[model samples]
Target: MTEVSNKTAVDPVERAIRRIQSVYGSWNRNTSVAQMRSDWDAAFAGCTVPESCRQASADGVDGEWIVPADAPRDKAILYFHGGGFRLGSIASHRDLIARIADASGCRVLAVNYRLAPEHRFPAALEDALAAYTWLREQDFKPKDIVLAGDSAGGNLVLTAMLSLRHRGEALPAAGVLMSPWTDLAATGESYLSRATADPIHQRSMILALAKGYMGDGGDPFDPLASPLYADLVGLPPLLIHAGDRETVRDDATMLAEKAKAAGVDVELKVWDGMIHVFQMFSEIPQAQTAMAAIASFLRRHLRLEAERVR
Candidate 1:
């Protein structure tokens, strides 16, 4: 993995990491899932949804629409939030989605898929597929839709595409993943290499989250659950972002390699000194750069007009 050196002793990236650690580091196996969900939402409570955005439902799944004023009505981004499947909500990721909508000039449909430990494996995947199908039913063609997500949500993006392809359904134009946890088995080498560098997530934490999502009798290597083991042939173009310091860094790298081998167009970026899903922190300059790259990729794949993109 290529590393980008951060010359600044203490910068916005460091501060953001510290802040996240301060809030999330205290949690342990003893912490209740409800409390963790509350804490997670509270951490991003300051984020404000745009006035144009509104609460909406995709099929029966709860979600919100993030519509930039200039965004076209036809093209849309289907978003899934991260938090290891058991946590995160539309509220926690509203700001980041809003920024993406503004940058790409496409309305975003951010869904709050059912969480795990209660919903378990296949539940979130079902919700994601339902949302995508709902969008298709709305007359949004698959060519105009893009699937995007972070961490476990990124996992859903891949699985959703695979499922659709298996069912002989039309696939979306492209996909964008941020620090996707493709391997629920957590067997990536970066778990050992970047363990000390990643402040927010560790091997133990990842494994626990994975287990909770999988539950008893669930296979960690199941292609639907852990997409790294799945056949990636015929999947859409992908743009993957990862942090050099993240323990799951290899998840992004390995997936990109495998997808490319399977003839899928893949672009992988490993940001130096960044943490998992660093794009959530707008204060970090790298976050802005990553968002811009996302916009560019989406605009190209979605065939959005240059005048429409900001």
Candidate 2:
């Protein structure tokens, strides 16, 4: 069965994503990672910073804390920014994470995890784990925190949780995944089936990215690299958001299925006519709806009540 159907008109943001893909396709593969990073930083430079959020740095991990003027101090969201684990940074994703913090009425710490083709493999994962540990050291109870990420960042969140579980450490109250690329193996049917529909990612592009992040001969299905193949038991509740029009659509579906089969509490949401990481486009109404849903999920899972102002 085809993964994406022409059921609705394409949203303007999806069109924009198509343009981005075209531009990305034109980028010279021989370009240095530093140059690519600089280019991306410029592309997203116009993203407006939210006045409602306070930004900070932690242990060399760039962080942006978005908490309402009256929100609770004990609860937090440790967010990992996504860039195929090679590009993107706190500056690029700050606006989106700020919106999340505002929506959830909880503090959000957007961690600038190390990138690949330089840091590689466990570097991003290690930073994610370290950021979570830093949160714990700051007196945030594990059960009061939530783990959130998109794309490769999503992989980091899941792998970090798995590492914590294997070490018999405290786990977060829940997790939120937005268009997570959980399978580095590129085995998902959507990779081909949704090719025409998804403008943000293509199979060849994705595989090249995976290889860059993993280096030569890296096992693609190593649980950390591909959490789809990981043991899902003992993980906390999860909320996964995906765009029906995206190549990674099956990544979310398959992970949800596996988590459910493992008896983990998992909720999968597939938005029609949406593109990958559509939540990052603040202008899109569906993005707001998705944020509202994420906020509701966080409040429910974290037992957090919106603070009432005097």
Candidate 3:
């Protein structure tokens, strides 16, 4: 993993951090889940979906097609939004997905998978697999598709890929993970080391979210639940972005080491002083750079022709 230093003005990032902290820091066990979901949606309500994208369903699975103008229809990205598997929706992430489509010059399928506490562990994974299967049935070759996700959604990306590999199905061309929560076990030292540094996520909240997804008896170390323990052999190339200040920073770094040892191509970038999934905050210059890097990595792995977007 490489640590990239950003010299951009910190004022914007600080403001973004304060905004996020204000929202996330208010949550507690007393807050109702429905209210939390609504707040999550409202937080990103200002993000406008690009005019070119269209709404579509993936074989009964709720989703939106973020297709940039003139983008090739054959290539697509399967994006999963992060909310600890209990929150987040197409509404909260449509704008970010649109940016990805605009950057990669490819269509993006952002799915609204089943959330947890209401639907348990295998539910989200099953929904993800169904969406991928729908894409395959539409004649989108596995090589032309890329899997991308952030946080808990990133966990889904890994588990979904593992499920496909185990079923003898072909894998996607590559994967892009942003601040992935790979270790449900929560054993990473960053939880302690970065405790004071991370603004939004903390150990207590992480464990609560894990329990909400896993229920009372779910195994934290289960390879399916936590890809940090899963075999990484034969998975497609991965581009992982992480923030050094985030509590899950170790999750990205440790996964990179394991994937590399397992012979999978892995590129891990640790952005100094950024927060979890910092790409969601467009005001931050690092977010723009990160999106560009993601676009370049996808084009290279998918063998798409480089065409400048005006």
Could you tally the backbone clashes for each prediction? 0, 0, 0
TM-score per candidate, chains pooled: 0.94, 0.91, 0.94
**Tens digit of lDDT per residue, candidate 1, span 1-310?**
9988887567888888787877678798699989989998888865544537788889999988989886789999999999999999988888888888888889999999999899999999999999999999999999999999999989999999999999999999999999999999999999999988888788998988899999978899999999999999999999999999999999999999999999999999999988999999888999999999999999999999884523
lDDT of 3 at 299: 86
Which stretches of candidate 1 lie above 4 Å from their native place?
1-10, 26-30, 48-51, 307-310
Question: Taking the tens digit of each residue's C-alpha lDDT, what string does model 3 give over 195-308?
Answer: 999988899889989999999999989989999999999999999999999999999999999999999999999999999999988888999999999999988877788857
lDDT digits (tens) for residues 89-143 of candidate 2: 8777877887777777788888788888888898888888888888888899999
List pairs with backbone clashes in candidate 3. Answer: none
lDDT of every model, 2 decimals:
0.92, 0.85, 0.90
Q: Could you give the candidate ranking by lDDT, starting with the highest?
A: 1, 3, 2
Residues forming the 10-long window of minimal summed lDDT in candidate 2: 44-53
> In lDDT terms, which candidate is top?
1
Report the Cα lDDT for candidate 1. Answer: 0.92
